[model samples]
Target: MRGSNSSLSSLSRRQPWKLINIADLPDAVLIEVVCRLSCSKLIFRCKCVCKRWLTLISDPYFVDHYLRHQSDKKRHIIRTLIYAREYVVRLRFHPWTNPTVVATYNDLMLCYGNLNRYCICNPCTMQWVALPRIPTYTVHRRSEVRVGFICDTPCYNYKEDEHEDQKGDVMQHNAAYRCKVVRIRPPEKGYYHFSFEWKVDIFSSETGEWRKAVVLSPRAITLNGLGFPHQGILYWLGREENGCSIIFGLDPFSDKPKCFFIALDEPLNDLRHFGVCGGCIRMCGLDMATRSLIVFYLKTEEDGKLCLSKRMVYSLDQNMYLDNESNVSLRPFDPNDEDVCYIYVYGECVRYKYNFRTRKWSTIVEEIPHQISYSFVHVQPWWPTPVPRLPQRACPAESN
Candidate 1:
């Protein structure tokens, strides 16, 4: 028995241990395994494993599955992207000339460049598609124009190929095939006097075409700034002919598409900022008379009517903006935390962060170039969204 045991031990020691190679696994299994990895590991580590891994990671189908899986695990984390003069250093790729982020939805960013140029980008994967040139709209030069971006589908648990066999233009029913860019142009020079409808031009990725539409307003209103999307709806801050402030919303994906407006208690102020926070639309404005910051949340009642409800008020130092020549504007609020806010002192070229929980303001960034405006969009960082494919090959984004 001792002689037999010794012989077995010797045999086991001499034999090489069998190892399992992850790359040898089936594609489906491989996807299932890699989808669980963190975005950093998957992008920086697994993608470097081999050509197959890089290809799999870049696949749209795989990206969709990974996003759904992450959503199921509730692993998404909001990241604020500040695209200032130094943004070029952080973003490795730069395809557009003088690109500025105009809008963001989920993980996609819509960047606008000089001469009516626009492009959609997935910054994490360094993928971007230059959209077709936007056509000129015949509106008054003084009319304010607003642009927005949105996805027709939900952000999670959605399969791009679910309705592949639906026997028609699959793009119509498949949410994955729809991404829209909307341009709101004010009424022509003399048209606003008789009509409340504003001319709207919509560009759809599936059709690669721009279509004309109109949104009716309760009264003639002027869009204040670039709008932001929340819950698949784009909302803009606007002022009416009577000087009353209003929130204009457009539901382009609804079965019956329509535009609606909500009245605000106060008139539109240059220092007012609008954004989405804590899964709700919130607005922060500097109350110059009171030397305080007032926050408002958009709430819907049982009757289905929407209204702004006062959420909080924070007193500001009287001396902070005593310089009458200073242009003090409330910066875009952080989407993740309702208590954290930013204020930009344009004249001083400084941005300060105020924490309502702590009631303190600290300098976040200073000495910003006056020419470089603060235009940014929020995205979920851990989820690396792939760029939507177009019929034409997308141009590669290059780094400076």
Candidate 2:
């Protein structure tokens, strides 16, 4: 028996090893392999390999799995809307580079301000639809219009996946259709005095109609900053008549929508920015006189009311050379990372990033470009959002 085992081992060593074919792997294993691939390779090369692969890659379930995998691996990238030339060329869609992107949600961009142009487009799918002009408001500099966008669809659950065939199949989203765009305009001033009301024009993708709503505030509010969407609610940063900073939040999906105000912490500085960071609404401000950065996080109480709490304060590193005269302001917050923050110094034309974990500051970019849009859109290439096609309506001018 020992001699036979030795002979078998010798024969095994002499024989060449056989390679395992990826096609022979199980569906779960194959999914894991595909999820690890880069977005470009998965979209361009993997999809073209076979019909099964094409169907798998395009399945909504697989997309969700891929996104989770990416997040687990901490793989994310920041990109500008203007830098989508390769995607535009590959998809054969005409690029619209002139309009400035006002809001980005679920990888879709709401671009405004190119000869009064407004549209929503998905860069990955290369699909776009032009929205009708604002009902009655004329474009002007001092108008201070705030725009917010939301595009949410229910994801496939694990229970639903268990019933599918061994070979993966695309799951249909039967009850998932929610997309909205809102334009918040300050109250129209009367000839004699100011009105303490605001006008909100809401556009629904289901109906393709622009409905107007009135938002009332106790004190006069000025919508000065960008509109950020968090947890199905859109928030606008503004100040009151007494120069106290406050946040106004509205739920577009509510049956009876009303603006809810959440007052910020005291001693608020003028140079502050709010955005979704660490899965919450975070606002950061820079104190010019003290060279200190204050960070505040929005939280919810048991009573279902929103409130802001001061998290921590970080003093600006002396090596940064930030002086009292420096025109400094908080830049757009990075949504994927909670440890990193960006601040823009207008006087020096440079952008710096601060690490909260280490409490260190470093320069990210020097000599900021004038043409670039500061409101950047974060996109995950592997997960492409489809732009819904709605019934086309003529522009107001055309109807006239």
Candidate 3:
């Protein structure tokens, strides 16, 4: 018996070393290898793998890493809508061969269309979640609804990861972290005596139910705008008591909403859009008489007063226009560091970069066939990383 055992051990030791294929590696080892790959390539290839690998790669941590790497490697592309006299069209930057309608926030892209009607897709993992229909309201015989996501208050415990060995508590805390959807709509035209009364309905993702309708304040109602949730608050561009446009920040954690006025001393003409830009809320207005684009930079003082510090004007001729009493022509790619201003010129759906140092602008990518859209969210590519995906495929079945 001892001689047989010795012979067996000798045979095992003599066996040639075996090579392990990447696909055969354990979950933890595979994840580490995946971290080294290009985000787009890794995502595209991983789909053909087994289900367990799919689930592991789809975790939020991997998604976050992939996004961070993508942003670090390239300028984030922004989606925009360009309105022509006859048609409203969609455009994207860094055109993809198979571009699908996607909902976009800061850096994250959700599938576009009705929240209840679309599929939520995570491009990085090619994973999707189907969601039920989102509620809506009608205005002027047409249902006008805007849907957005808001992070749940009392943020999930971040420290649990430090003590992963304590599994029970960590799992409990993670399960409690949740998010909700906020829907905004104006009341039907004839239903309310006041035309400005708007109803805000919130749907909790955790509970999957709509909350009671909450009437907005007079100022918030009149604006009839959607809020951009950032840093635990929902911010909207609103008109103040004096009728000047300003940014209002709403912290759902508190009972009363906090307001910040973007005090542009100059008169605003035909204000069209408001959004968060470069960590501050920004409003864009068009000077109709001159066909010039005006962007205002807002600041908050120690005394809590809001002030508009910088005014930039871009004329149709593609030149930068400084704020002067005299009519100014716009300049292309002119950047003002003091005002934290960066100007991106659009030509044939391609965005060119203009460095303040060179005082010159050049095309980043030439001859790209995709139409590109420019919006405030495009300015900061890192902001939309967590945007949720739609629930269903937006295109028709036959088309897919």
Instruction: Give the whole-model CA lDDT for all candidates, comma-separated.
Output: 0.66, 0.64, 0.44
List all candidate RMSDs to the true structure. Answer: 6.7, 6.6, 9.8
How close is every model to the real structure, measured as TM-score? 0.73, 0.73, 0.53
Q: Which residue pairs show collisions in model 1?
A: 94-398
Task: Judging by lDDT against the true structure, name the best candidate.
Answer: 1
Count of steric clashes across candidates, in order: 1, 0, 20
Residue-level lDDT of model 3, residues 94-131, one tens digit each, is 12223333233332333333334433333333344434
lDDT of 2: 0.64
Winning model by TM-score: 1
What value does the lDDT take at residue 135 in candidate 1? 66
216-320, model 2: which lDDT tens digit per residue? 876666766667776677777776666667777877876656677886634466534555555566777666567788778877565545776546779976666
Residue lDDT tens for model 1, 1-400: 9999998899889995778888679999998988877764445467888899889876767766665666567785866646566455534586555676767777778876656767777666676777766666633232256788988665444323557564322111133547888888765654234347778777777666667886788777767666676666777777777765677888777544578678775643553455655556777766666667777788655543457765677887655664653377776666677677777676666778898779998886544334544456556655555556655432333211
Give the Cα error of residue 294 in candidate 3, in Å: 3.4
Off by over 4 Å in 1: 1-13, 16-37, 44-78, 84-96, 113-115, 136-144, 158-177, 186-195, 254-257, 300-305, 323-327, 345-351, 358-373, 389-400
Using alpha carbons, what is the TM-score of model 2? Answer: 0.73
User: Which window of 10 residues has the lowest lDDT sum in candidate 1?
Assistant: 166-175
Model 2 residue 344 CA deviation in Å: 3.5
Off by over 4 Å in 2: 1-37, 40-92, 95-97, 113-117, 137-143, 154-160, 164-175, 189-195, 265-267, 302-304, 318-323, 346-351, 363-373, 392-400
